[model samples]
Target: MESFGIVKAKKNNKIFVEFTRESACGESCESCSAKCAESEKELFEFPNTLSADVGDVVKIKTRDRSILSYKFIVYGIPLILFMFTITLSYYLMSKMFMKNIELMSLIMGIISLFISYLIIKGIDHKFQKTNKGDIFLEKM
Candidate 1:
């Protein structure tokens, strides 16, 4: 994907870029009375390959991302982890003749979901170090 953003700051070897986040509706407010289809902002860090300065508008491009894989990792993994944890916990609890098996399984499932978040974070950090979806930037 390609986008334009303004450089917000620089720290270490990373340049912080501020982008106006877009919505699925494309911020079309003409037909809507609420006028709530406004844009929000997002901050992203990129390698300062172009030596872009703060306040500069830059064009950014990214590659090496598969949307399907990303979706599965971010959404599917947590769901699968939660379901697996619930099933396993329930089975173990039942085998042990423990009371409140359902409640315990549910608690375990929720905990596993949080753990999945940590796992995803770790994977993201590692991939970032490797620059999986390497971004290229140039001053606009």
Candidate 2:
């Protein structure tokens, strides 16, 4: 994905860029009917490869491959984990002659989802601290 932002700050070899909704809106807003440009601003850090200064507009790029991995982490892993846990719990409960095996499996699945959520949140926190990611920036 490609986006445009204005450099918000500079520190060492890193530059923080701020992207507003209007700047990210690609096409002419007047002709569009979709409720596309929500009011928000996103800040991202990138290597200072372009030697951009504060208040300068820059172009940011993110590879499609990296995006796919992010999608899997945010959506796929929890779903897969839930399914696996539910199936495993159901089989185990059945073998143990437990009553309400379906209910037990559902409860186990929900528990697994909660665990996955914590894991994902930790990963997100670590990434936020490091500020090291796949974004590439250049002067516009």
Candidate 3:
């Protein structure tokens, strides 16, 4: 993925850029004004290889594969785990306990969702350490 931003500061090889944050609601919702109240610009420090200077407009890019994997980890895995655990727990409860299967399955599904969150946190930590300098910058 690529985005354009203005460099706000420089320290060694790192450049701090300010870019507009994209709204998930697409700025079309009339019922909610909370998103509009939030700041639009977000700052990030990226390792600069392009010799970009403060006040320069630059293009930043991240690998598509990296983004895809991140999305899968953040959104996909937990959803699948939640549904799978619900069904599996219900089935097992029906066979073994034969009582309160619905309640038990709901509880198990929530537990599985929490476990998925922990797993995602661990994965995110590892990925951050290994992919610290994955972003690239180019002067625009």
TM-score of each: 0.78, 0.69, 0.74
| Candidate 2, 1-140: lDDT as tens digits | 88789999999999888997563465557666774754579898877888889999998778888788778888988999999999999999999999999999999999999999998899779866774567666698
Ranking by TM-score: 1, 3, 2
Residue 107 C-alpha lDDT in model 3? 92
Q: Cα-based RMSD of the predictions, in order? A: 2.9, 4.4, 3.3
Model number with the top lDDT: 3
Candidate 1, residue 27: lDDT: 57
Give the per-residue lDDT digits (tens) of candidate 1, residues 56-111.
99987766365456678999999999999999999999999999999999999999
Model 3, position 78: C-alpha lDDT score: 96
Segments of candidate 3 deviating more than 4 angstroms:
10-13, 23-39, 48-52
Span of ten consecutive residues with least summed lDDT in model 3: 30-39
- Which has the higher TM-score value, candidate number 1 or candidate number 3? 1
Q: Write the per-residue lDDT of candidate 3 for residues 24-139, one digit (tens) a residue.
A: 65555667857563438999988777788999999888999888889999999999999999999898878896788898899999999999999999998998789865677789
Candidate 2 vs 3: which has more TM-score: 3
- Report the candidate with higher lDDT, 1 versus 3: 3
Error of 2 at 40 (Å): 1.8
Q: List the residue pairs that clash in candidate 3.
A: none
